[model samples]
Structure formats: structure tokens, C-alpha cells
Target chain A: AQTVTQSQPEMSVQEAETVTLSCTYDTSESDYYLFWYKQPPSRQMILVIRQEAYKQQNATENRFSVNFQKAAKSFSLKISDSQLGDAAMYFCAYRSGGSEKLVFGKGTKLTVNP
Target chain B: NAGVTQTPKFRVLKTGQSMTLLCAQDMNHEYMYWYRQDPGMGLRLIHYSVGEGTTAKGEVPDGYNVSRLKKQNFLLGLESAAPSQTSVYFCASRTSGGPSSYEQYFGPGTRLTVT
Candidate 1:
């Protein structure tokens, strides 16, 4: 079984600043996918970014980027130039290449301080 | 496109009552999933389907049942609801296999409260 862990329960970042939410996973498979999802007060799950374990180059999407270390089994999401709207509950998820299911972390509540 | 839609956005039921949640997607996805979101727990998969007329149990399928009679729709049913079942239920769908199959599109979610 694969499990994702988000060590930080809550994180706060000032507007225009940068913050990183740490996540780690336990998986025996070498080929898999990692994802970061954002759920605001609206309770809608939005994809922030994703990284393929086989790819060493970090994935960057606009102001969001991920530091994926496959050997360490660590995938962290970094939010830069944070805005108030960026405040949400962030989750880390993992999906094995051979499976259709996704395992998610507990979550990290991100607070953007204006 | 409406993407994905869930019927009965909110519902309240007494313990032992039964209810069904309908999830429909217009993306023609072959794989659909049912998940629950609790206070501290992010999201746990309850059941999923690979295609029409096929369903499989997920991590927390003990108290839930699901059916996928159509490729665009997935239904979750609770024969006897319990307070522990009070949470937000989410529906997701994705391609069966492809470059973008890793991504799952989610619905708005249905909030259910069993007292």
C-alpha cells in the first residue's frame, strides 16, 4: 500500500512571499506520479501541479513548483508570490503507474497573510 | 461542458435511512471514482469503476456500494446511513489509459449529514 504524508499541518505565508509545503510518500514502485491539490473554502479540489517520478526536472506551473526527489520519496510544493486567493487546504497525492487509484496525504492548511 | 456534476448537492438523513448519490461526467471518461472527505482526512476512495457495468472496492468500501451502469455516470448508495458517514462525498473521472490518465477531474461534491 502506498501512503502520502504531509508533515506540516498548517502553514502561513505573507502576501508576495514564498512558502513550501512538504510531502513524502512510501512506495515500492519506481514509476509513479505525484500531485498537489488545492481545496479552498469552496471545497473544490483543484490540481496545482504534478510530477512524474521518472522525470528529474522539477515541474513548474506559473507560481507553483514542485521539488520532487524520487530517491528520497519527497515531493514538496512551493508557492511563490503568494496571494490571498492561494490560501487553501493543500494535499499531496500519489498514483502508481500500474494502478488507477490515488493515495492522498492528510493535508496542510495554507494561510496567506495579507 | 459541465465537466462533472453531482445530484443532491446537500442532504440530511436520520440514522438507518438510505440515500443515493449520482455522479455524472461529460468527458466520456472510462474510469470514475467515489471518495469521501472528512475533517482531517484529505480524501479516501470508497469505490471506483473502470467502465460501464464494472465496479471495484477501494480503501473505505465497508459501508458503501457503487454501480456504474453507464460510462458517464457512477452511483453510490448507502443502505443504512450512520453518523460516521456524515461527510463530503466527491466524484472523479479520468481516462482509462493515456498520457493524461494520471489526472482526475472532480465534481463539486455532495455534502451529507446523518444524524
Candidate 2:
């Protein structure tokens, strides 16, 4: 079975600063997909960014980016110039490159201070 | 599009009680999923449907059942609710092709409490 882990239970950062959330997964598959999802107070799960294990280049979406180390099974999300709106519960997810099911890690609660 | 929406945003049930959670999507997505979120745990897939009339079990499918009768609707049912089953439920829809299949649009979850 594949599992994802988020070591940080909670994290806080000042507004306009940068913060990185840690994530690691256990998978034997050579190819898979990784994703970062944010759940705001509204309880809506929004996709932040995603990375493919076969790709060597990291994925970036505006202020949100990911540092994916395929060999280490690490997929970390880095939020740049964080704002109050960035406060949310962030989750790291894994999926087989050819499968539709996604497995997620225990989430990290992020707080952005003004 | 209204995106993905779950009916009965808040529901309370007694032990052994039965209920069904309805999920509807405006997008003509081929994949729909039902997931549960608990404290300290990220969303866990309960059941999913690849297309109309086809359902598959996810990581946790012990106490739940699901159906996808139409292309845009997926239903989750609890035959006997338990306290441990109390959690926020989310419905998501995704396209089932190429690179875009990884992106899932989630609904504002439904909070269910089983006492």
C-alpha cells in the first residue's frame, strides 16, 4: 500500500514571507503523480500544484511551487510571498501515473499572520 | 458551471440510521469521487466512479456504498451509521483523459455527525 506523510502538523508564517511544507511518500511505482491541495475555511479543497515523478523539472503555479525529489520520495510545497488568503489546511497527495485513485497525507494547517 | 455540489450540507444521524449523500456536477466529467476528511487526516477516498454505472472501491470502503447512475451524479449511502463515521464528506469531479486527469474539482464538503 502507498502512504503519504506530512511531518508538520501546523505551520505559521508572516505575511509576504515564504514557507515550505514537508511531505514524503512510500511508493514502489517508478512513475506516479503528486499534488498539493489547499482547503480553506470554506472547506473547499482546491488544487495548488502538481508534479509528475518522471519529470525532473519542478512544478510552479504563480506563488505556489513544489520541490519534488523522486528518488527521495519527497514532494514539498513552497508558498512564496504568502498572504492571509494562504491560511488553510494543506494536503499532499499521490496517485499512480496510470491510476485514477489518489492517496493523501495527513495535512498541515498553515497560518499566515498579518 | 456550478462545479461540484453536495446536497444536505449538514446532516445528523443516530446509530444504525441510514442516509444517502448526493453529489452533482455541472461539468461533463467522466470521473466522480467520494471522500471523507477527519482530524489529522487528509481526505480519504471512500468510493469513486469512472463513468455512469461503474463504481469502484477506494482506500476505505467498509461502511459505505456508492452509485453513479448518470454522468453528472454520484450518490453515497450509509446503511448503518456509526460514530466513527462522523466526518466531513467531499465530492469531486475530474476529467478522465491525458494530463488533465490529475486535476480534481472538489465540492464544499458536507458535515455529517453520527451519534
Candidate 3:
């Protein structure tokens, strides 16, 4: 079974600063996908970014970027120029290339201090 | 577009009671999923449907039942609710195959409590 682990239970970052959330996964398959989802107080889950295992270049979306190290099985999300609206619960998820199911980590609560 | 929506934004029930959560998507997606979100547990899949008539159990399917009679709707039912079953439920949908297939759009979530 594939499992995702997010070590940081909570994180805090000042507005306009940068913060990184760590995530690691255990998987035997070579072809897979990684994603980061954010849940705000409204309880709406939003997709932040995603990285394909076969893509050596990490995925970046505006202020959000992922550092994906396949060999280390690490995928960390970096949020730059953080804003108050960025405060939320962030989750790391994994999905195998051939599978439709997604395995998720516990989550990290991100607090953006303004 | 409405994306995905779950009915009964909040509900409370007594032990042994029964209820159903309705999920509807307007994106014409072929894949629909049901998941439960608990504190410190993120979200776990309960059941998923590949198409209109096919349903499959997910990581945490116990104590839950699902039906997909229509292509745009997926229903999750709890025959006998338990206190442990109290959690925020979410519905998601995505295209079966496409460049955006990996993306699963989520609903606002339904908060349920079983006393």
C-alpha cells in the first residue's frame, strides 16, 4: 500500500514571506502523481499544484511550487509571498499512474500571520 | 458552473438512525467519489463510482453504502449511524480521461454528527 506522510502538524508564515511544507511518501511504483490541496475555513478543498513522477521538472503555480525528489520520495510545497488568504490546512496526496484512487497524508495547518 | 455540490450541509442524527448524503456534479464528469474528513486524519475515501452504474469501495468503505443511479449524481447512505461515523463528508468529481483528469474538484463538505 502507498502511504503519504506530512511531518509538520502546523506551520506559520508572515505575510509576503515564504514557507515550505514537507511531505514524504512510500511507493513501489515508478509512475505516479503527487498533489497539494488546501482547505480553508469554508471547508472547501482546492487544488494547489501537482507533480508527475516522470517529470523531472517540479511543478510551479504562481506563488506555489513543489520540490519533488523522486529518489528521496520527498515532495515539499513552497509558498512564496504568502497572503492572509493562504492560511488553511494543506494536504499532500499521491496517486498511481494506473489507479484512480488517491492516498493522502494527515495534513498541516498553515497560519499566515499578517 | 456549479462544479460539485453535496446536499444537507449539516445534519445530526441519533445512534441507529439512517440518512443519505446526495452529491451532484454539473461538469459532466465520469468519475465521482465520496470521502470523509476527520481532524488530524485529513480525508479518506469511502466509495467511488467510475461511471453511471459502477461503484467500488475505497480505503474506508465500512459502515457505508453508495449508489449511482444517474450519471450526474452519487448517493452515500449510512444505514445505522454511529458516533464514530461523525465527520465532514466531501464529494469530488473529475473527467475519466483527459489532461485535467488528475484534478479532482471537491464540494463544500457536509458536516454530520451522530449523538
TM-score winner: 3
RMSD of each candidate relative to the true structure: 1.0, 1.0, 0.7
Can you give the lDDT of residue A66 in candidate 2?
Answer: 90
TM-score of each: 0.97, 0.97, 0.99
Per-residue accuracy of model 3 over A48-106 as CA lDDT, tens digit each: 99999999999999999999999999999999999999999999999999887899999
Native-to-model Cα distance after best TM-score fit, residue A47 in candidate 1, in Å? 0.8
Using Cα atoms, each model's DockQ against the true complex is 0.80, 0.89, 0.89
lDDT of 3 at B52: 94
- The collision pairs in model 1 are none
Q: Model 2 - which docking category? A: high
Clashing pairs in 2: none
Task: State which docking tier applies to candidate 3.
Answer: high
**Off by more than 4 A, model 3:** none
Q: Write the per-residue lDDT of candidate 2 for residues A3-85, one digit (tens) a residue.
A: 99999999999999999999999999988989999999999999999998889999999999899988899999999999999
Which candidate gets the maximum lDDT versus the true structure?
3
The total number of steric clashes, by the backbone 3 Å criterion, in model 2 comes to: 0
